[model samples]
Target chain A: PAPDSAAQGLALARNGQLTKPPGALGRLEDLAIWLAGWQGREKPQASAPQVVIFAANHGIAARGVSAFPPQVTAQMVANFRHGGAAINQLSRTFGASLGVHALDLDQPTADFTQGPAMTEAEVVSALATGWNAVDPEADLLVTGEMGIGNTTSAAAIAAALLGGNAQDWVGRGTGVDDHGLARKAETVRAGLVAHADALHDPLEVLRRLGGREIAAMTGAIARARMERVAVVLDGFICCAAALVLQRLHEGALDHCIAGHVSAEAGHGRLLAALGKDPLLALGLRLGEGSGAALALGVVQGAIACHSGMATFAEAGVSGA
Target chain B: PAPDSAAQGLALARNGQLTKPPGALGRLEDLAIWLAGWQGREKPQASAPQVVIFAANHGIAARGVSAFPPQVTAQMVANFRHGGAAINQLSRTFGASLGVHALDLDQPTADFTQGPAMTEAEVVSALATGWNAVDPEADLLVTGEMGIGNTTSAAAIAAALLGGNAQDWVGRGTGVDDHGLARKAETVRAGLVAHADALHDPLEVLRRLGGREIAAMTGAIARARMERVAVVLDGFICCAAALVLQRLHEGALDHCIAGHVSAEAGHGRLLAALGKDPLLALGLRLGEGSGAALALGVVQGAIACHSGMATFAEAGVSGA
Candidate 1:
């Protein structure tokens, strides 16, 4: 669907709901109603909201963009398995099923070693692997990426795909200081220059500098389109994946909803290019689907308002 | 606690968690961690989050600051009983038990009459009623008010408590137009003049113009202080009640957690007087404990992080 057509659906959902007057439900109500129209139903239902965690090692970690060592990636994955990560807590809270996929981007299989980011083919395959892991019947999919120093990867990808200086879109990831950020920015710039021609293609750029997790998220978004599953994006990193998918298929964006805006610099540019608004702004920079998880309640509130709120006719109240 | 004291607790919660590094959980994680310390427990628990709704008639409703007629106050109360209002939906979704109480201020409780704005005796009675309504032991209590033309009442209370201009604090409640707003402002000014002597005695002022609900909420906040329960505040209106409680018992401020900052102009003054910072700012003006309901999850998240997240000691992760 083009932007106009998708917006029309949103408008219809906003108007025809059986609840309170138009826009009474606020933004969440708007989303639920929009999703209802997208699903072509009056009572849009979400049984299982799936959160896909894409994990890959970033080569830029060597540039000291992150306070923790790159080994934290694999370690966090193990932690995820043990259900100790933030995402794990959010998954339980939101009742969203969590799927953790490791993108073996030629880094250490069990520890950490630096290498070129996953090849383009590897990126696509890793995404496919994660996307395939989802039950196609899942009501909605929220994509989150987990990779040490991946902020550097995201900045490079955004610069190449959206056309900008890498330094502007980049920010301190994992609490790196000013000097560390400078080095990280320089490293990202070099990666962009080295892969400029390949950067002409979003997939090519992702493969060149994006970690396995990002590629996996791109694949997940693509698969979501194929399966007609709506994708709720978490912060700047995941939006990078959505941008790649938008290039592949403009209609793919119809399935995307930005959960919240990040303090990260590039997120605004990506959101603008995609022509979408981030629903919440709490100055969150942490990834791992925490923002997306918070947005789930908003979405749920929307659904409840649309499905449960009494209209003027039903509640016998006057409407403006 | 001072800002730095709260910040220290946040720093602890941000760090020493098993999954992510310090600041990895973002602002929410820091908040949750801070709340745990307030509870005096490493892991805080929130089994029952309570929202007490106070319904009263405002003297300003006579001035016409609202699109809806004042009769809508009792109508909304009926709607609430039937569980058809937005607040009803929110309390249900957030799993926070809700209590609605009517404070009688010598106004006609007759079928057509709006309500009793409190009298000092009525204020004391309403607070007593509200105090008795809650569990002797509860984790958190949220105080919210519902009334037509309540923003005018709130602005007046804020002005009286904080010594600000009523016009400066007043806003368009329920969508009043410019002419209606001017009338509303005039109404606030007239009410201020009419009640100046009574307002000089805060309790007397509350009895004169504060609706039964505002009086009840003030009592509930005072009760929360006595019971040592955390009180989550919504917006300007709620903050006005909080200010009264703060005036009545200075320690009452300790139990409050500013839930969300309102787009309401007076909220800034009210929050400043209370010496609190709101956790979220979503441009919300819907006053049915909607802001507090949203904050419920954050409070729960804070308690959960303290209780559930594995410490570095437990997970055997290296400290920074």
Candidate 2:
């Protein structure tokens, strides 16, 4: 049996116990009804939505392509641990469990103990680690990422996937000026030129130019598909991972939902390639599952409207 | 004594807290710290924010200026009463109170006769009515409006206030076509020209060209200022009322904050007039306080950061 899409959910929405006008809840109503079918019930609940923020070091950061230093990754990861990052604050507000994982793509670990980025074996292990951290019966999953200059990595990965110049996908990251942006674009072009043939396979792409966190997130998407857990993808970095996962397994995209369309330069092209419409667009460039965290609320609204609002029949209102 | 706009409830953050290095939380920390001071409390709480939506009929609707009929004002008001409007759902989600007031601007109650766009007596009474509805002691006040052909009315009102050409301020209302937009702009020009001499006073301008809801919202903004409550202004119609309120009482402008800059042609100009920075700009043209309602979460985040979250010294972190 295949996982349900919004169309299937809309169908089940018609059968709900309440008899409201069709599409009464608007987007929210539609989402709620869709979720009900996904849950295989009349009402779907998201009791425990898990969000994973994969933090990685980007090779482009070494080129002074970002306003902040690459060290901000470790600094932000530590901040996340301390509940100071925007993602940490937002996840707490939404009552979603947030996990942070480090992907070693830009810089080697102290003593060079950890492999660069991650090998296929490491990616699988990391996936197992993240999956084990969540309940086997988790209701939903959200994928997010954070890395200074990761936009460059994302653009390069996107260029490799879509056969475009990295210059086409590079954008302003953390408010960099025109000169820094130019350098960032140049660095992406260089990385793509260096790793073009090597990135033909998704795993090779991750190994050649992908960050450790990107590989793990790809694995997480693959695992979430197998488990039939609903997955929401946030912004550029996670989209790169989802693109990889989609290529590795055609059906994996079925479990995925694009949370929001980011204003990042390459995000639109990536979304087009993936054939997804983001649930929201607020010009948010801050990636950290903030978009997915917001989508959870939308999903919750959908569920509530499905379960709680009085239908036209119940309210005795004439149908449209 | 005047309300202390400068009372240092919280300091503008130059450094991140959480016992971490400087600049760890990045822009979020600065945003949080800025909000803390603005709220006038060490821990400014927005648990019960207010969202006031004012609805009226526009004289320009007489020109057949909108997709829906003018009666949709009353119909949507009924929708609001029935809690079917998008803003209603959003307010419920944010735990904010939604206040709807009818301003007799478009179609006055006759024989039981009141003038279109309430008289000064009606405006004062409506102010009291709306103010009394705000719980008097709420944390924040959000003001938005709905009126068919309101873009025409709003543009006229804004032009009168800014002393600009009406056509320059006018935009398409509810997806009006090029022909409709041209006609609408012409209507604004006509209204402005007709009302210019009569609108010697801002209140008179509102009465001459504004809708019932705009007048009511103007009164509400004034009352919010008198009571020292922060008002979050939404889009052009609200901006029009805000301009009226500012003209009537310059001090009223001090109590207002911009929720988002609308994609409306004149919204930016109006916002610039008041030296206000809108918190978000997502090209939103939907009325009903949708943009303002969306911005509630950000204001809440600002308040939470101000009220919650330990200070650098409190968290034992180094300061800049």
Clashes of each: 7, 11
lDDT (Cα, tens digit) per residue for candidate 1, span A1-320 = 32235544654654553333344344655576567755556656555789878787866676677877877777777777788777777767667899888777346221112334664466667767866866677777888877888887788778878887768878876677888888777877787767766777877767776767777787787777677677788888898877887777676788778887877777877888888887666667778877777777666655655556665556666543
What is the DockQ score, from 0 to 1, of model 2? 0.12
Segments in model 1 whose C-alpha atoms lie over 4 Å from true places: A1-24, A105-116, A247-251, A263-265, A318-320, B1-15, B104-117, B198-200, B247-251, B316-320
> On residues A115-185, what C-alpha lDDT tens digit does candidate 2 reach at each position?
23455676566556555544446678887777777777677678777787767888875667798889877
- After the best TM-score superposition of candidate 2, give how far the Cα of residue B4 lies from its true spot, in angstroms: 5.6
Tens-digit lDDT string for candidate 2 (B1-320): 14443444234432333333343333334444443444554455667888888777755576766665776677667667787656776677667898887666445421101133445676566556555656558777887777777777778778777787766887765666787888877777766666657666887777677766766677777777667677778888888888987777665687677877777778899899877888656566767776677666666644443344444455433332
TM-score of each: 0.89, 0.75
Q: Write out the backbone clash pairs for model 1.
A: B32-B302, B43-B306, B43-B307, B54-B213, B55-B213, B56-B212, B118-B207
Query: Docking quality tier of candidate 1?
Result: acceptable
TM-score of chain B of each: 0.87, 0.86
Candidate 2 docks at the CAPRI level of incorrect
Q: What is the DockQ of candidate 1?
A: 0.36
